[model samples]
Target: MATFAEPLRPNVASADVQLPGVRDYEQVDTEIIGTLKPTAGWFGALGVAIAMFLVGAAAWIYQIYWGLGNAGYAPPVMWGVYIITFVFWVGIGHAGTLISAILFLFRAGFRTTIYRCAEAMTVFAVMTAGLFPIIHIGRPWKFFWLIPYPNWRLIWPNFKSPLVWDVFAISTYLTVSSTFLYVGLIPDIAVLRDRETNPLRKRILAILSLGWRNSEPEWRHFMKMYLFLAAFSTPLVLSVHSVVSFDFAMALTPGWHATIFPPYFVAGAIFSGIGMVFTIIIPIRKFFKLQHYVTINHLDAAAKLALFTSMVVGCAYLIEFWVAWYSGVAAEQDYFWNRVFGEWWWAAWIMLTCNMIFPLSLFSQKLRRNPTWLFILSIFINIGMWFERFVIIVPSLSHEFEPWQWGHYVPSWVDMSILVGSFGWFFMWFLLFIKQLPVVAIAEVKEIVPPKLRSHARGHGLDPSGHHLPYGTETPGEFD
Candidate 1:
């Protein structure tokens, strides 16, 4: 709830030697590592997050004892909140890959300010998402049966089924994302190791650092491995979401079957993911007094990204409707009509407003740069995207096939509790992470700070002299 106090470097010249957010290069570590030490407010937020997770855990326990009857599922609409949320969280995980991998490959410098936290979100978002399928299954104890494994009976899991793909895709995604996050942290961890005065903390940091000495040979190998992993991760980000879309598009059910789904879902995933990053990083910058590090310029770039993706998604919506009209498919036409005019019509309208209408506000540079507006719009996008998934899943199921078989589904308390809990679990992990590790990558960010700034600051006695600095210093270079 705290606000940014430092004036944003909006008109900063292109030729400025030092990056806008940083002054002396050596101060990057001190600025970032301070976040590892928590305040009372962080503890308070952590408590709330833990409480939310516990609420969901209690609901799951109750459901386990009472069976699926404890949930909202019934008749034609057997899938409800869990499936919607699964899609939501999975979509939320996409932006991290977009920022950390795709943008890195393209050589974007802005990513340095935000990629660490974004990557953390990707890992935790997937962890939250991986839960729903298990929770949705009537017998979670047998969820492992979904996995392909050697057996004496010689019966393998269904390779043709997208359900099986979900199992493999999500597990593989979590593994790669976790590795990406830890790999990025190694250099920062070594920084922590060197700074620590306590013996026990140093030992833990040493184990985590794997003897990283930041030597030239080590730096060469690290960059190669990091880029190799990024290349490997690039396709997985695309494929994992495409496979998720297949879960629906591969089905022939009314609104579910379509060629547009793969791209639509991917765009929606990135759009929602970017929105969430805004929702997160805004508070982080404000509360942690990181305005200098995460400037309005950084936020503006992200807002532009969210706006572009939102328009792409908005076009996808129009295309689906146009295709339905042009194709003359009765089921598809009925599904679209029902979505707009039938039961849960409110949801359809809400989704359109959130995903299509609200994002249009970002077209104004004034609104995009306004932190308050950006935060509100980001929350709206997240909510709208969630209902977009709900509208897609539920209406189709509610009106499928024979009128006699059709039935409506309503969310039970269990559904609401688990939904709230999943959010809690996610933030809980994120808060703990920020408390224990540098929220931004100190090394990557330092690469952008002009060495001249440090020299100039030293000349003015604004910072300590170069030789006395402990974080290692680089000599200043003249402009080309």
Candidate 2:
């Protein structure tokens, strides 16, 4: 997601060199660390999230008492709102990994500012997504049975099941993303450890920092480990979501049988996740006064990314329908046609309008750069993407062959409460994260910027990628 940047200048020397946006090294630390303090607004937001979380808890309890019937789960549509919500959150989780690991591997330097919070979102979103499976399983206490482990009873998971693959895929993704976020934060934590005076707080940060010393050896090892982790985790972005898609693709259901499922799901996941990223960062950037850090340029870059992924998803939608009709498969054709013209036709059109038509607005530079427009459109994209999963899951199931067994699923209050609560769970974790930690990566931002900026300096003028920067010219629409 490279933004428009000016052409590079070659005359700058070591101490005078700086990234185009930043001011100085000392100020970078102050600005980033300053974000951790809790304000009244922060607490107010947290309170709402906590309240919603409680509502969800109560809903779960009621569901337990009433059994799965409370969610309107039925035979043909056995996978109801719970499975749909699971896939939605899983898609939302994809943006963090995409922006953090994949963009890093691709060397998109602009990602440094947004990656920290985005990575944190990945961990929390995955946690939220993971819960749906447990919730979907009627026996919550027996959720542990999904794990394949050696035991006295000798029970094991179904090795061939996509559900089993999800356990591994999501667990692996969470572990890697958490480690990546923490590893990237060690230096910043050490900085906070030094900045704070309290004995208890300093000690905990010191432990978490693993004794970072700003030494060449420490940096050398850190870079090595970071690179290795980024490379290793990159493929999981595609694999994890592909496995989730397999939960549908492996089914014999007409709409679920495409070989295109893997890439299609991956594209939609990135699209929804990028939409979510904008939804969070735009306000945070303004409220936290991080304008210089998460610049309009950065937002422009992200909007472009959202547009790109939306197009990919839109193409996948078209291809799915075309293939269904082209194959002359009665069941597949019927399932797709019912989606656009039958009982669930409304959901299909909503998905197409939101995911495909609305995203084209970003092609206008004015709209992409306008924060208010960006925010509103992002919200719509999120809603549209969610409906995409709904239409995909429901229509096929509701209009399956032998209309006698066909049925429509409507979520009960319990289902809606839990669904809303999942969002609260995600936001609550993020709010706690913002209050306790630097929302941006201090060290990575400093890497491209020079140690001193107001003086005539020597060497180190080149970027981390070894390109000499344009010192004075301010050009737009170009990037490394």
How high is the lDDT of residue 153 in model 2? 89
Q: lDDT of model 1 at residue 245? A: 96
Best by lDDT: 1
For all candidates, what are the clash counts? 0, 7
Query: Which parts of model 2 are misplaced by more than 4 Å?
Result: 1-21, 453-480
Q: In candidate 2, what are the lDDT values of residues 150-233, reduced to their tens digit?
A: 899888899799989999999999888888888888898989998988899999999988999889999999899988898888
Please give the lDDT score for candidate 1: 0.86
Note the Cα lDDT for every prediction shown: 0.86, 0.84
- Highest TM-score among the candidates is held by which one? 2
Window of ten residues with lowest summed lDDT in model 1: 471-480
